[model samples]
Target: MKARVHVMLKDGVLDPQGQAVAHALGTLGFQGVGEVRQGKVIDLDLAATDRATAEAQVREMCEKLLANTVIERYDIEIG
Candidate 1:
């Protein structure tokens, strides 16, 4: 199975990096750029064949180490 995790800051959290990028883009003439939130993606290759089990394991990974539960949220995609 293949798994992908998308981690991002929760709304209401300030994102300095995203703001910098947006400002840079505007300077370069990429107009109309609104609020930008930066995020990360983690792709994993797993041997588990059971969809349910794989998803559960991945969720555990997120809860334990992949995401900052207080300020970030994560979504999992399995293929």
Candidate 2:
């Protein structure tokens, strides 16, 4: 089984890194790019065969170590 976790900041939070990227893009002549948010994707290979269990485990991983729940939200995808 494979699990993919996406971690991102919640809205109404200040994202200096995202704003930096948007500024750099404009400097490079890219236009119409407004409000860019940065996030991360974590791909995991699990030995568990059950879909529910795998999702649970991955969600635990995100809550425990992968994501900063205080300022971010995460989504889990199992395959």
Best by lDDT: 1
Looking at model 1, the pairs that clash are none
Model 1 regions lying over 4 Å from their true place: none
List RMSD in Å for every model shown. 0.6, 0.7
| Candidate 2, 2-23: lDDT as tens digits | 9999999988889899999999
Name the lDDT value of residue 49 in candidate 2. Answer: 100
- Report the error of model 2 at residue 52, Å: 0.2
The C-alpha stretches of model 2 lying farther than 4 A from their native spots are none
> What are the lDDT scores of the predictions, listed in order?
0.95, 0.95
